[model samples]
Each structure stands twice: as C-alpha cells, then as structure tokens.
Target: MWQNLDYVSERRADTVMVLSGDHIYKMDYRPLLAYHQEKEADVTIAVMNVPVEETHRFGILTVNRQGRVVEFTEKPKERDKGTLANMGIYAFRAGVLHECLPRYAQQYSDLDFGHHVIPTMIAEGYRLYAYRFDGYWVDVGTIQAYWETSMALLDPDSPLQLYDRAWVVHTRSYERPPAKLGPQARVARSMICNGCIVRGRVERSVLGPGVYVSPGAVVRESVVMNDTWVGPGAVLDRVIVDKQVVVGAGVQLGCGNDVGVPNTTYGDHLRTGITVVGKAAHIPPNIRIGRNVVVHPHVDEEDFVSYGDEVPSGETI
Candidate 1:
C-alpha cells in the first residue's frame, strides 16, 4: 500500500488518506483533514480510546496534550500503556511519504504501518498528530468480534445506527427481488435482506441476501449469509453459515452443552460457542453438529461419513 505514495506524488496531491476495508465505522474525514492542516502535521493517524485490556489487539499509542503522538507500539503483549488505538486510518503528506517510504524499505524488513512505519516516523522526529474519534467504530478483525458486531446491529440503541439519514453508509448492492415471508414464517428482531424467502422461525438473527429458509427450520442467534438454504427441521443456534451453504433437514447445528470445547483448528477464534460453516458446504441430513464445530468450505455431503451422523463439539470437517 505504501507504493501508492508514488501515485500520490505523481497526482500532485497534498495529502493521501489510507483506510482499512475490514472496519465498520461512520466518519466524516473532512474534519480530520482540517485538523491535520491546522496542525501542519506530516502524518495524522486516527486514534480511538479502547479499553486498556483490549489494547493488545491494536496499535497503541501515547500522545501529548497537544495531540502529538510520542510513542507507538503494535499489538504489544504487555498492554499497560494508553488506550489510544490506531484505527488503521492515516493521512500523510504526499511528499513526506514519497520521500520516506523508499528510505524505510531499506531500513526495515517488514512494511507494516503500525509495526514499522509509524514508529520509525516518531523516532525520526516527524510531526505526527492523533485525531481523536469518539464515535462508533469497530475493527471486526476476529470471528468473535464479527459475530458480536453483527449482533450489535440488532440493538435498537446501538451506537452504529443504520437508519440515520444524516450520514448514510452505502454499499454496492445487487439487483434482487424483495424478501418474502411465508404464511407460517415467524421472525423477530432479525434482519432479512433482499432476495430472501423465509418460511421458518428466525429470531435474533441476520440473514443475508438470497437466503431461503424452509418450513420447520429454526434459526436463532445466528448469522446466515447470502444464498444459503436452511432445510426443513434444521435448528441453527449461535451459528454462522457462510454463503451458498446447504443445511440439510433435521440437522441440529450448534447443538449440545459442550460450548466450552473450542474448535480444533481455529480454537482461539471459535471458542465462544459459535459454530462456523464455511461457504458452499453441504451438511447432511439429521446430523447433530455440536458447539464450536467448523465445517470447511466446499465440504461435500460424503465428507460427513467419517462422523457417523453426530459431529462432536470442537471438531472440524
């Protein structure tokens, strides 16, 4: 991404803004750019105050009263430092970046902004400032965080309000037919996106585009993505079904009390009692998949023969 510095210089741009794609936030960058101009900053990083205990997951920084960044650490193990976290958003002077990126490439083996670039800039006495953001911003970098953030959207009092017209968050959407609910369908506190056809019970869940839930299917506390088919009598609880998956009839996903068992492969990510089914997987009928199970992408129905109808908790298929 640092290679874009050359394009910035070629375009004769005064400054360039860098943003991460995996984050969900509503912000007006105009104010931040104005603050950067006012401070005559060589680089301005957007920082937010997270809990000190959670600082280990982010690029923590210390700033003076004038908002000048003094120190920067990326994902430190001992996180007793400040809670100001780098939001992976930066505004850099075009000339400064065009000048420094090549020089830093020779100095450091890694090109990470948090680990190498920003720290080196601070050490070299560059005029770096921090723009404080107190609004709703979430770095959904982990599976647990993504699930939690998705669930948070259902909250009526959530900080991230999608219905607000003041600052609308737009996305590239496909042209699809409107979502339909059958006469027997029962849905509560869930978001059924366009192109969905529901005839089952969905509570406290989010269904993406083109999903079809057959009758007698019960999806609770789950996130089902695009083009997935929930078969009849299938019960999904605290599960995340990826795009184009086929949950067979009478399959009980996220079942059993063994929620403590973490996934065998991605234990750190799937330990929170959430079973994950990757894209295009075909789950067999009447299979009881326990908590924290991981169904890999493109898994065929024949692949479940090894499990013999019951996939125990924490197993990956």
Candidate 2:
C-alpha cells in the first residue's frame, strides 16, 4: 500500500495514519494520533498484547521502558517474553513516509510495511514509538478466524460490541423486511439477518439477508450468506456457504469429523479445514459433500454427479 502513498504525500499532510482494513477492530484513532504527536515520533506503531501461542501469525515487537520500539520481527517462529504484536496500524510523519516509501519501493521486491518498511525505518534510526492498545482486535485472515469472529459477535460478553449506539459500525442499509421463521422452525444461538425465510432448524449459525432455508433442513455452526437457497432435508454443519448458492434436497456438507488438513484448491486459506461452497455454485440434489471439501464458484451439476454419491474429503471441485 506504500505505492499508493503518493496521494497522501502530495496533500502535504502533517501526519499520515495507516490502518489495515482486513482486521476486526473497534478503535478511536484520535488518541493514537495524540500519543504520536505527544512523543513527536517519526513513526508510531500500534501494538497489542496477544497470546503467546498466536505469535507466529503476527509481527512481534520488543520495546524499551520508554515505549521506543527496539526490535521487530514478522511472523517469528519463536517468541520471547515480548507478547506485544503489531496491530498493523501506524502513524507516520508525512515527510518521513514520503521519503522512505519511495526508496523502499525502488530497492525491495517485497514492500510490506510490517516485513520491510518498518524494519528499514528502524535500521535507519528513526524515532519510532509503540502505542499500546488494550482493546479487542482480531485479524480475520483465514476461514476459521472469520467463523470464530462471526460467532463471537453473538456472545453477550464479546469484546467487540455492536449494540452500543455511541460507537456504531455502519454498513450499507438494505430495504428488506424482517426475517421470517416458520411455525415449526427452531433457531437458537444464531443471528438471522433481514429478509431470511427459515422453515428449518438453525442453530449456532449466521444467515445473511434473503436466505431461504426449506423445511426439514438443518444448519448448525455454519455461515450462510445472502440470497442462498437450501432445499428440503439438507444438512449443513461447520460449513460456509457464500452468497447466492443452491443446496439441493437431501444434500449434506461438512461431515463434522474434519481432521483439519490444509488445502488451497478453493483459492482461500482455511484454518479448521471446514467445507466451503463458493458463491453462485449449484449443488445437485441428494449429493453428499464430505468435510473440508470445496465446491468452487459457478461449478455445474456434472461436477458433483460425476463423483457418484459423495464428494470425498479434502477434495476441491
């Protein structure tokens, strides 16, 4: 993203604050900026204390008592007592950013801020400070992370609060009506969004807008996105179905006995190795899909029918 910094630099700003959009976080940047200005730092990085076991997934930092960042490593295999991980939020002096970003872009093939830019700035003796953030933050980088974050939103004690009117996370509003559940339908510990018509059992699942779950279908511990159609008697457990997909009657996805093997045929990384059906895909009637199987987007009925009755575990279609 440093390549895109030319616009900010051209504006002749005093400070440039950069943040990662992929993370699930709720923070007020005003305090961070104030701290940066108070320290008169050339670069200020937001750091948070994460679990030691999760150190390999983030850029770890070791800071002096003065809050001056002394050492930084990206995705280290081993970590010390310094559990402060980089939150991918930085405040840089405009001049320093403009000067260093261009030099780094020209010199290095990998221009990632955590991996190269910040480390290069530290090596050049920049006055870098660490801004300690104690709030809740999670990087939704993988499927399992996404699922866990989604489920966490339903918890009453979740750190990431959404019901607070003062700090609202706004999104594009839809004109759809309230979700409708059938007389015999049963739903618990789930979030059903607007315009969903549920005539089946939905437990510990999230249903996006305009989803239709037919009678006798069961969805548990899964996320079904917008406008999807689940036919009668279908079963989905520990699965993620993207927008506008069709699941036929008696079809099953996610065997609930996943071994968590890594596979990348679905174009996205999965942590729990759960089954994923891409957007707009069509699953034929009575077909069974095993755990960790991926049905690619826009795949035809022949793909599943060709596999006989069930798609094997860990296979990507």
Q: List the residue pairs that clash in candidate 1.
A: none
> What residue runs in model 1 are displaced by over 4 Å at the alpha carbon?
77-80
Alpha-carbon lDDT, every model: 0.93, 0.88
* Per-candidate TM-score against the hidden true structure: 0.97, 0.94
- Model 1, range 91-200, lDDT digits (tens) per residue? 99887887788999888877888888899999999999999999999888778898899999899887899989998888899998999999999999998899999999
TM-score of 1: 0.97
| Candidate 2: regions farther than 4 A off | 256-273
Among these predicted structures, which one has the highest TM-score? 1
lDDT per residue (tens digit) for residues 118-140 in model 2: 88888999999999999898898
